[model samples]
Target: MRARVHVLVKRALSVVLSLTLLATINFSAHITSAEAKTRKPTIAEINEAKKKEAEKKAAADKAKAQLNAASNQLKVLTAKAVAARNRYLQELKKLEIATKKAEIARKKEEAANKKSNAAQVAVVSSKNHIGKVAANAYIMGSGFTDFDSILHADGPQDLMDRLSTLDAVGENNSSILLRLKVAEESARLAKIEAEEARVEAVAARKEQADATARVAAAKKEADQARAAQEVEVKKLQQMQDKLIAELLSARKKRVTLEQQRQLAILEEALAARAEQTDVKAKVWPVNGIGFSKGRTTIRSTESIRTNAVAFAKKQVIARKPYVWGNEGPNSFDCSGLVYAAYRSAGLGYPEWDRVNSRIYYSWTKRIPLNELQPGDLLYYSYKADISTIHHITIYAGNGMMWEAHNTRKGLLYSSIYSIPGLIPFGGRV
Candidate 1:
C-alpha cells in the first residue's frame, strides 16, 4: 500500500512539473511577442490599397497629360480661326474698294464712248459737205472753179479772196479729222482700263470667299477640339475623384490594422485574463470547469486523450500555407485549419467557413475562457450577434493559438488578444 502511495505522489509531482514548464514557456513567448509588436516600425507603411493605387495614379496622370495636349490643340485651332477671320475681314475691305473703283472705271468708259460717237458724226457731216461742194464745182466748169473765177476776175483782190476761202475750208476739214482720231484712242484706252478693273474685282471676290471658307473650316476644327478637350477634362476629374475615394477606404483599413496592432502590443491574452479574472486557465475541474465571476459559463471537457490528439494533429499541420477556401492536409485557411484539427482528433467539426458556421453550430457547445482547453475553437467578432464573427483560431493552450491568418503570415501561433475584435464565444467539439 505504501509503495502504491509513493508511486501516486511521483505521478502528481510529474504532472505539476509538466504544467509549470508549459506555463513558463507560454508566458515567455507571450512577452516576446508583445515586445516584438511594440517595437516602433522602421519599415515603410504597406497595404493592399497602397500597391494597387499606383496603377490608378499612373492612369490619372496619363489622362491629365492627354487633357493638357487636347487643350493646347484647341487653343492652336482657335488662334488659327481668329487669324482666318481677320484675314477674311481685311479681304472684304479690299473687295469693297476694288468694287467701287470698278464702278467708276465703267462710268468713265461709257462717257468716253459717247464722246467718240459724237466726234464720228461730226466728221462724217463735214466730209459730206466738202463732197457736195466739189461735185458742184466739177459740173459748173470754169465759172464755179477757182481758176475760172480768177481768169474772169477784174482785179488781183478777187483772186486773193478766192484762194483764202479755199484754204480755210481745207483747214476746217483737217481739224475735224484730228479731233475724231483723239476721241477714238481715248475710248479704246478707257475700255481696256474698265476690263482690267472688272478682272481685279473678280479676283478680290475670290480671295474673300477663300478667306471666309478658311475661317469656317478653322472654326469648325476649333469647336471639335474644344469639345474633345472638355471631355478629357471631365474624365480626368472623375479619375481624380475615384482615386480620392479609394484613398478614403484605404485609410479606414489602415486605421483598423493599426488598432489591432496596438491591442496585440499592449494586451497579451494570458496576462489580461489573469489580471481580470480569478479563475485562471487550467485543465483542473474544481474551479476551472465551472462558472466564473463574470457570469461566464466554463463547460467541462471531453477525454484528455481526444483533445491531445487534436492538438498533436494541429501541430503536425502547422506552417502549412493558407489558401482562400482550401481545407486539407496540405493547404488550409483559418477555418480550414480548425476543421482539420478537430476532425483529425475524432471530433465532428463543422465542414464550412467559421463565419457560416457561427449562427448554426449549436452542436459545438459554447465554453468560456476559463474552460478553454487545447483543440477548442476560439471565435472573434465585433458585435453580439453570431453574424459578426469573422475569424476563427484554434486554442493550442500555453497562452497561444494556432491560425492560418493570411497568405503572407500563413499558419502560425498567436496570442488570443492579438486577434482583432472581441471574443464573442468559444466552441468545443
Candidate 2:
C-alpha cells in the first residue's frame, strides 16, 4: 500500500512539472511576439536621429557664437564711449577758454571806452580854454590883433611896448592851440583803440559761440556712445551675466595696466632726471643729436633765461595748489603755471595778462619733439590736432615737465608721457 501511494505521488508531481514547462513555453512565445512587434531601428533611421542631434548642437553653438560677438561688441562700444567722453571734456575746456577770452575782450572794450570818453573830454576842455583866451583878448581889446597893435601906438616907446604885448598874446594863443592839437590827436588814437577793442570783443563772442557749439556736439556724441554701450551691456547681461562681468573685469584690468605703464614712464623719467647734472645746462636733443650736459663755466643769455624759467617752475612745482583759472603766487592752472614761469623769467606778458591755453598755444613756435628744452612750452591737444589744444606746461629738461595738472592732482613734476594727448611737437616761446 505504501509503494502504491508513493508511485501515485510521483505521478502527480510529474504531471505538475509538465504543466509548469508548458506554461513557461507559452510565456516565452508571448515575450518573443512582443519583441518582434518592437523591431530594431534601421540604419537610415539611426542616421536621421544623429543628424537631428547634430542640428541641435549646431544651433546651441550658433547662439553661443552670437553671444560672444555681442560681448566683443560691448567691449568696443565701452571703449568708444570712453573716447567720446574724453573728447567732450576737451571741448568743454575749449569752451571755458573761449568764454574767458570773451570776458577779457569785454573788459578791454570797457576800458577803451573809458579812455575814449576821457580823451573826448580833454579835447572839449582844450577847445573851450582856447576859445576863452581868444574871447578874453577880443573883449578886452588888449592887443586883440596885430593890426590894432600897430595902429594904436602913441610914441616910439609906446609902439615898442604894444608890439611886445602883442607878441606875448600871440605866444599864449600858440600855446593854447598846441594844447588843443595834442588833445585832438589823443582823442583820435583813443577812438581807434576803442573801435579795435569793440571789434575784438565781437570776434571773441563769436568764438565763444563756436566753442559752445563744438562742446554741444561732443557731448551729444558722448551721450550717444554711452547709450549704445549701456544697451550693449544690458543685452550682454541678459544673454549671460557672467560674460559681461568678465568683460568689465577685463576692461578694468586694461585700465590698470595703462595706469601702470604711465607710472613706469614717470619712474623712468625721474630716473633719467636723477642721472642728469643739476648745475649743468642740458643741450636739448634734436633728431637724436646734441643731448649733452654742459658745465656752467660759460653761460649764454639763452641759458640764463632757461635757468630763470626753470627756477621759477621749481619754486611752484609742489608748493602751489592747482586752481582752475589762477595764475599767481599761491595757486595756478596749467596755462597759468607756464605763464607765471615765463613772467618770472621776464619773457612773458604782464602779471595782469590772464590768457588761456589756446592763446598760449597760438603764440608758440612749434618745434620738433626731440628739440624740447628747459623753459619751452608743452602743449597738449585732443586727437592730436593743434586746433583742439587745451593744456600748457613747461618742459623741465630730461624728458620731464612741470604742470598745474588739475584740482585733484595739483602741481606735478611729471614725465612727458604722463599726461594724455601729448603732441609730437613742443612750443618755443
| Cα lDDT computed for each candidate against the true fold | 0.58, 0.60
- Per-candidate TM-scores read 0.40, 0.39
Candidate 1 local lDDT, 388-414, one digit each (tens): 556777776644577778888787666
User: What's the lDDT for residue 191 in model 2?
Assistant: 62
Total clashes in model 2, counting residue pairs 3 or more apart in sequence or in different chains: 0
lDDT of 2 at 333: 86
**Which parts of model 1 are misplaced by more than 4 Å?**
1-58, 131-157, 203-429
The candidate that wins on lDDT is 2
Per-residue CA lDDT of model 2 for 312-366, tens digit only, reads 5565533678889887778888877776776676654342266877666556566
Cα RMSD for predicted model 2:
41.9
